[model samples]
Target: MRPHRCWRPAAGGWLGRRLLRPPGALPEPFFLGLCLRCGQCAQACPRSAIRIARWEHGLSTGTPYIAARETACDLCGGQAPACAAVCPTQALHLEPGEPVRMGTAVIDATRCLAHMGDICRSCFNACPLRGRAIVLEGALRPVVDPALCTGCGLCEEHCLVEPAAIHVEPLNP
Candidate 1:
């Protein structure tokens, strides 16, 4: 599991950041309306990816979200996502062809050892989308392909560097 570390947005954290939602989740408002805050998704997650929001999140308290840097959604292998399967309100959906669209990852090359002339493939190896989402460049540096990125945050979680060289930017809420 990835260790705890807070992500601070450019404008500061709580005021500017949005919570990362689970895969196939309805837009923020819609999901919130239908979600029963029952914690079923959290219980069903095999990877323990979903966490219920606490009081600090205001109206979102008890809502389900994926704190990707801490734990990322695995989409329950190739099967229907476990969280969505157990959600009685269907706040989360299942689309046959789309695997997921949690968010996209952006690499800070200054911190990336590979980009700094060291051989590293941590992000590439950790990406759930693998070859499609993260590719190795000529210098063996990992490059992200946004079109294929599922934003699972496995790359960020597996990063060997403290503060992680690569981090997942959450979807706009």
Candidate 2:
């Protein structure tokens, strides 16, 4: 006999005006919501792309923040996000092969720790599309190569510091 696939609860999930909500007890979207925020999506992630946002973003407190650090649906291939599969939330709106507009990654050299005098290259290393997407503007700073950039937000996500020097913005909407 097959065992029952019981679901668990995720702590400190974030809610937004744009996001869809379901019902009671299970936070906002009941029935459909069943995530434990255990970070399975991050682990299964081939790119190590998923990220959970902190309190600093304001809009997203404990919720999963994908846009800021690593945008672009590289894993989806014009389909759905793998991370959502782990999410109990029908909250993540898991769809098959749905075309998604991923956010774009950007770098603010002036504010970047690398540019500010820190010998940090976290952003450069974090970018999956390295060499093509992001490149060294100088010994101290990095620049985003628009020509080679798929606009993946990895650089923004793994900045290794607060007020992320790299910022990922939504595509032209």
Candidate 3:
């Protein structure tokens, strides 16, 4: 069956992966339809993890997005996500204690220190789900379990590599 208009993947992702949205954001078209661009979500973020989309984002301009390399969502220390809490519309929604599956972190093994025979577990150590979302193999390489990953970007943020061996992909968008 043909995908519904609102349910189809956003065009941005057709060119490249979608930008990381704030935790609990609705699907792209639904979010764009409902979001008021009020900036409330960005303001509610304790870590200032949310940013207004720039003009370059085209249709997504003024929407709340997260740059994991700069800062990652902390889910307000496991409470309801602040961005979702402050959303006046259904653009975002997070129930208390719900894990934020914002995106999935993928590791570039070619660039990862551990995969190079060095010992680096920064991504594993920074994962909110600890051993569940990210794990270490016998060779000391960090592996991501997509099913369990919250995609909160902590691993990307904490990566010690210059370009970051791990990066979050907006899988849900």
Task: State, as a TM-score between 0 and 1, how close model 1 is to the true structure.
Answer: 0.87
| Predicted candidate 1 versus true structure: per-residue lDDT over 96-139, tens digit per residue | 77678878888999999999999888888877778888998894
lDDT, each prediction = 0.80, 0.52, 0.84
Off by over 4 Å in 1: 1-15
Question: Using TM-score as the measure, what is the rank order of every candidate, best first?
Answer: 3, 1, 2
Window of ten residues with lowest summed lDDT in model 2: 16-25
In lDDT terms, which candidate is top? 3
> Which residue ranges in model 3 land beyond 4 Å of their true spot?
1-10, 13-15
lDDT of 3 by residue, 50-136 (tens): 988875566787889888998998868878887888899969987766767888899999999999999888998988898889989
TM-score of 3: 0.89
Ranking by lDDT: 3, 1, 2
Tens digits of lDDT, candidate 2, 1-173:
64223311232233322221111112333422354555566564555545654554333344443454334235444334566666654545435644333445677767788888788888788776666577777655777766555445557667876778777654422
